[model samples]
Target: MSDTTGGLLTIAALIILLAAVHKPFGDYMAHVFTSAKHWRVEKRIYRVLGVNADSEQSARSYTVSVLGFSLISIVVLFLILVGQKALPFDRGLPGMPWDMSLNTAVSFVTNTNWQSYSGESTLGFAAQAGGLVIQNFLSAAVGIAVAIALVRGFVRSRSGELGNFWVDLVRGTIRILLPLSFVAAILLVSQGVIQNFGDHTVHALTGGTQVIPGGPVASQESIKELGTNGGGFFNGNSSHPFENGTPFSNLIELFLLLVIPVSLTRTLGTMVGSRKQGYAILGAMTFMFGAALAVVTWAEAGMHSQAAQLAGGSMEGKETQFGSWASSLFATATTGTSTGAINSAHDSLSPTGGGTVLVNMMLGEVAPGGVGAGIYGILVMAVVTVFIAGLMVGRTPEILGKKIGTKEMTYVALYTLSVPAIILVGIGLAIALHGTPGYMNNPGSHGFSEVVYAFTSAANNNGSAFAGITVTSHFFQISLAAAMLLGRFIPIALVLGLAGSLAKQGKVPVTAGTLPTHTPLFASLLVGVILLVTGLTFFPALALGPLAEALS
Candidate 1:
């Protein structure tokens, strides 16, 4: 088959697969959440923590308790990071630098998983297993809790409260993520991904000594993809042999990264009592994802062709074992879900491929994005799109029985625009400063894309980078760090507030006149909205980078 035909086929196959999975996974989540069996497990956990799980608590009280527990977790993890060298479980590596500790702790807590510190040289095994791994699970759990809270808003009658945040957090972590992680971690270990307390060893290679990196890699690897926490256990990330040892392991990791994001669509439909609604959203996400994958794959393949002719520009930053297609696919997938694990250095990818990754991140990562955050984030955009379209068509906008009113539209607009505002402004300031003699590297268009992509990744909680850019400077560090924190928290706070407001409103019953969000019409509109918003914001910047590369 021709490349074009193959691309079309693959796109169709993915949509069908997602649509098929929707009902089953949706039913599974609905059953798990409403089941008495799971309640027993929640009760046990609450009992262990000395809280009366069965007590009738207000929503405000529950939210406070959940936030309080998260704060405590953050403090404990911070202490572990700060004192890892002196801690008993330290495997002899030096303790984390103060700034690095703060960055890692904040990164993990925010689910951004941005790592400024080198994994092999700086962190000890204890910190990896105890602090980082624990946060991976907890951070993902936070996303799932937020998603469930949003679901409660759609399900509840007129009430100020959605659901108990504490209960949602506990149930999501214990009942869903923990159990899945256990299975996935074991599978990873079986595939030669490491899991142990053994010290790092030196292997005698043909010419020189090579340090063989080891740690609780399997545990972190499982949740890294599962929770959409993309921080890798090693500096090389999934490209590292220990983290992804085999082709089988590679496929499994990719699937895990996609599973929850895909599954949540089903959960959304289930909560709203319409499986088609979830399918529509999934269709839209899959279409954008498939387009990204095709462009990235073609760009990389074309680069390999160019490299063959030049007999130069070795694909040095990529994994030879995985080859170009796998590496390109991984790059696309990582950004697609806001999971930043890279099997190859994106910076070295042909300009077009790297540009695709940048644009993908800039799309607010709503293409079935970060864990629970992705689905809800995209849905907010979908709501906004419907609202706009409704205005043109002279109709009230309703999505899955929830009316898209002025208040909800305001929240969506703010949430969607918040990160783009930070990213654009940060990049603009960086270029203006760097264009001066002292800071210029390449001092041209490509350099600007690197800065823009970095801020976009950080601000959107997508951690992939164009590795060529030197981001270690204080200016880059401070700017990107601020972007990461605000981009991560602001949207989350807005979504939560929207959910609270929505919970207080009565659901508008679906009628014959209601616009079906599940159909191809709505899916197409959602895609158009995503492209229009992202394209309009970033077109000039994109023309500067990938477009230039392609033309040249």
Candidate 2:
């Protein structure tokens, strides 16, 4: 099949699958969060953790619980990574260096799987499975829990309570993530993703020995994509044949990363007692995603350069099994969703194509962002939209009957500004440091793009790299770790704060002056606000890097 035809067909199939599953899966999630009866196992686990699931928490308490749990997770995972050489499944690999250990630990704990080391060479099965994989589940669960709490902010009236963080976290893992990951793992293994415990050596066609590494890849791959964690069991990530063996598996991984984020919109609508609101949010997300996919695909397929034309397409750094179109799709999906698993080397994308994905991350990945992150991210945008609309219309801003007052907007402003601040500042610092030039593999606009991409990915909790820069130095390591940590928890803390503020307000009855947020107009406004905010903040950086390269 022609690449264009194949790409179109694959996209069609993906949309159909997403549509087929959206309502049922989204509604099921709503039920999962709202259900009164807890599973026996959940109760036991809660007891062991000293959590009173039945008791609700105010926003402050919930935030503390989340921060405390994640801090503990980081420390524990750090020790596991740094001490992995002593473990039985070491695979003859030494423990990670102190700085890299801290970076990896913070990366996984924050749900940003930004790796500075190759997975196969740097980690053993014990670290990959016992440490990283466990965080994949919990960190994702934490994001979903926060999103649910934010939803509660909209649903409840005149109350400070947003559900218990412990309850949401446990239920999200046990009831939602676990079963889905189990099924996905089996499907991936059936599709030829490796599921073994050791490496094997083979004779190469060049009469050389090759060591093929193997691990419990299927198990890790499932949760990695499903949770939107995106750390690869092998450094090649989804591009590695053992992790994503075929065209079908590639599509599956893409679907796994995107499904939860897309479906959570429906959950938002259901929980708010207005499916139209969810549809509005979903509409905006879909529009952004589709537009982005088109731009990257067009850019890659155009074959603008002399070399690309000679090669018949922009084939450099893309997997042969998955041509430019599919690679473009993967790039768009990975960046747009914040999953960051690259099936193709993002650094080798055409300048335009590269710029689009960078813009995707700059848009905060809310074009259906990461698992729990997307829903809340867009909701914050929606609030900003209404606030703008209110100013325009000379009326009070409200959504789902809750007023977007000064306190709420304070949280929204900080939530919106924090990540961009981290991204830009991080890039500026990296560029100014004298030793940074040594890290550049490409020395001009492309090099600038690489630094921008790294910090953008890290600060947004997206975790994909542009692949040409070396970030192993202490400065890059610590700075990127700080970016990941702040990029994650700052917005989360603010979102929870917004939730608490919203929860305290009594629902304002709908009236003639009230703005209808569930309409197409509102979705368009939300999209505009997202674009305006991102463009204003990141356009200068883009112009300096990708835009300059593309134009030149």
Candidate 3:
């Protein structure tokens, strides 16, 4: 009926749908990873890759496999992108420049689809489907594999082995992502998402001509959201009618981006034999997500600025089809998770609203982050929280019966610092260079925010941009690519190393002094740890940017 009613319905339906599927989908994923028997097709894939399906890997071996696989994927995809002009379904597009190709390759391979160019104008079907879309599935599977490996570390005792990386990757793709994406693609196409091989021209009633771009959008759109990979088939991303189509499809996309990450909490509980522990993590995520949504909705709807008042709301960059409330909901979902699919322009959000989303990313997107990334990210925080609590109580911290000793805390510390380090260092370098100012659309505090948002998005592997800065220069392309790669692999290596160390330890017995991490108290502490860490590290930088703009 009304936008407000539709927005409320959309929010209610999303929560209900996610809750309904949480257990079944999560348990299905658990079964997919842990089952002993493999499909004939999976076995064939193992043979092709020369992987020993029955064998397991220690954390070191698993980390090496992950790094090696991602490196190779980046190179292959880079070549494919640079050579796209000669590929089938070229669509008369030229090959991407070498730097942009490298950036795009790193972006997709890292599951951060940060685009500096318009997708329809820059990439052909061959590059879109064969390179970007394929990497979308593989990269997301890699993240799932890593998260499960970490889970195995918690589940096992006195063992160095996590699991077979190859098995996890293939099974995640074939058994989970593939089937889900197939169904989602059909649904999106039915909702008017384009799925074709060619573009055509059309004439307007005013006698002007327009070229409508078309591709296998529905297919790519499904995995892009389902996998939490945010590369859009169009420059307008989910805001484009052909990609998102309608309010119903927009709601579906939001649900798709969130479902896996939310369900993975259930998967964690199911696998670890502790649903309450999973609920603790889920509760922390839900609280932060709800808080961000509220702040953003209030800020946008209030329209506090003089210009915003004249427009009636913060409606400048939002689509008419989805009003301020719906757009704010989408913004919250996209930023809260690492989905990065936007139904509205984040750059035009009220200063307070924009700041909230920025902080959401700065909190490492653990308000239910990317597919495999969120579970592990929050789990790392959990370990840190436990360690802090243990120190306060003058007892050694243990979670799920595993001791958070020196080695584990070291890995946790590195994991905690890695993304922030990348973001800060990258931003410093970008701002120090005189050429950076040329890229900004504004020249004051708002301009500073654009720079912070770019590196923040890149380093966190969340691909959404503030849209007020141009990042197509060779400097931006290469540097942001480096940030994406380092931000992604460093933490992954540390996570796997932590999993290995934890798996090597024998479980400690819980005693009267032991802290229960699955309670509301623990969830609150976890949330506090997230906020404390992010605020401490990024508050100064934020004060100079969105904080300054919002106040002014």
Candidate 4:
């Protein structure tokens, strides 16, 4: 098939498969967190963890549990990493350095999965499969729990209790994430992703001997994308042959990363008792996803870079087995879903393609966001959209039959402002750090883009680095760790708070004055609001970085 045709088919197939499972998966998730019935295994696990599964919690209580659990998880993982060399099972690898361990622990637990250090050489099997993989499941489960809590806010009234955090967390992992990941893992293994705990296999080449790495990659790979945690087992990430051996592997990885985030829209629609409203959000997400893919494809095809000019295409940093079409698709999908698993080097993307990735993260990643993150992120933006429209029409802001008041708006305001605040501050600080030796590999406007992109990825909880910027220092470690943690849980806290306030109000009767959030017009409005807000927020940075590089 032709390049463009192949690209269209790859992307189209993903959307189609997602459509097939959206209702079933979404409904299953809805049933999971809300069901009164508990599995016998769930009961046992809860007892073991000292969790009272039946006890409901206020939003504050729920938030506390999330924070407490995450904090503890971070500490546990850090201990595992820092003490790896002495551990019984992880016998060979050296313990992680202090700051890297802390940063990595925070990264995985927050669902950011940002890796400053390569996984192949640095971490042992115990830390990789046991510690990091555990967080992959837990962190994703935590995200969905928060999203469902927000849904509860819209659906329930006159209730302070959202749900039990432990119950929600357990149900999400056991009921939804684990099952899906299990099946995806098997599929990946069959398609040549490794599933072992052995040492690297050695082979002799014409020039010299080569040592190929092996691990429990298929199982971790499945959840890495499926959970929207993008930490790679190898330094080359998905671009590495062993991590993703073939075009088919690339295709399936793309599907896995996007499936949950895309379907969560349907889950939202189902839980809120309005599938149309879910469709409205999906419509907005699809628009942005499609637009990014198209522009990226065009940019890659244009081969705008000096390197691309020599290579005769956008093949400089892309995996040739997947080709430019697949590379562009992967770029858009990874950025679009908060899945930072790169099949190619994002830093090598032509100026336009790389900037689009930045723009995707900057847009709050709401277009089919990372697992639960995308749904709530977009929904919060929806609140902003309706509020703006309400002002223009001089009507009370109401969504899903509830009045959006000052209290709800305040939560939305905080949620909206948190990301840009973190990103801009981190960028300024990173630029200052630029004067240090080895801080940047590329100097000039493109170098500035690398700094901006690093903070953008961290603050947005996107783990994909733009490369060419050294982030191994104490400054980047602490600062980026802070950005990932705050960027993740702070918005989650605000969403839960909004959910709490929204839960307390009784649903209003629909009227002529009520804004039609389910309609196409509202979907368009949501998209417009997101674009306008992100454009205004990040435009200056863009002009100075990618845009400047492109113009030059």
Specify the highest-lDDT model's number. Answer: 2
State the local distance difference test value for candidate 1: 0.78
Stretches of candidate 1 above 4 Å error?
Answer: 1-23, 36-41, 48-73, 200-208, 304-309, 312-314, 434-443
Error of 4 at 162 (Å): 0.5
lDDT of each: 0.78, 0.93, 0.92, 0.89
lDDT by residue for model 2 (1-552), tens: 787899999999999999999999999999999999999999999899988889999999999999999999999999999999998789999999999999999999999999999999999998999999999999999999999999999999999899999989999999999999999999999889999999999999999999988899999999999999999999899999999999999999988999999999999999999999999999999999999999999999888654587888898888889988889999999999878899999988999999999999999989999998999999999999999999998888998999888899999999999999999999999999888878988879999999999999999999999987999999999999999999999999999999999999999999999999999999999999999999999999999999898888
How many clashes does each candidate structure show, in the order listed?
Answer: 0, 0, 0, 1
Model 3: CA > 4 A from native: none
Candidate 2: lDDT of 542? 96
lDDT of 1 by residue, 288-344 (tens): 998999888887766443443475533657777676667777888899998999899
Question: Which tens-of-lDDT digit does each residue in 1-552 have in candidate 3?
Answer: 876677778889999999999999999999998999999999999999999999999998999899999999999999999999889999988999999999999999999999988899899998999999999899999999999999999999999799999999999999999999999999998889999999999997899999988899999999999988898999999999999988889888999999999999999999999999999999999999999998998888776655598977778888888888889888998888887878888888888999999999999999999998999999999999999999998999999989998999999999999999999999999999998989998779888999999999999889999987999999999999999999899999999999999899988888999999999999999999999999999998999999999888
lDDT of 4 by residue, 1-552 (tens): 787788778777877888898889878877887789999999999989988888889999999999999999999999999999876557378899999999999999989888999988898888898899999999999999999999999999899989999998888888888998999888888778898877765657666667667788988999999999898988788888878888888888988898888888888888888999999999999999989988888888876888889878888788778888888888888889887889989998998999999999999988789989999999999999999999999999999988999999999999999999999999887777536436877778888888888999998888999876888999999999999999998999999999999988998999877889999999999999999999999999999999999888
Each prediction's RMSD over C-alphas, in Å, is 3.1, 0.9, 0.9, 1.2
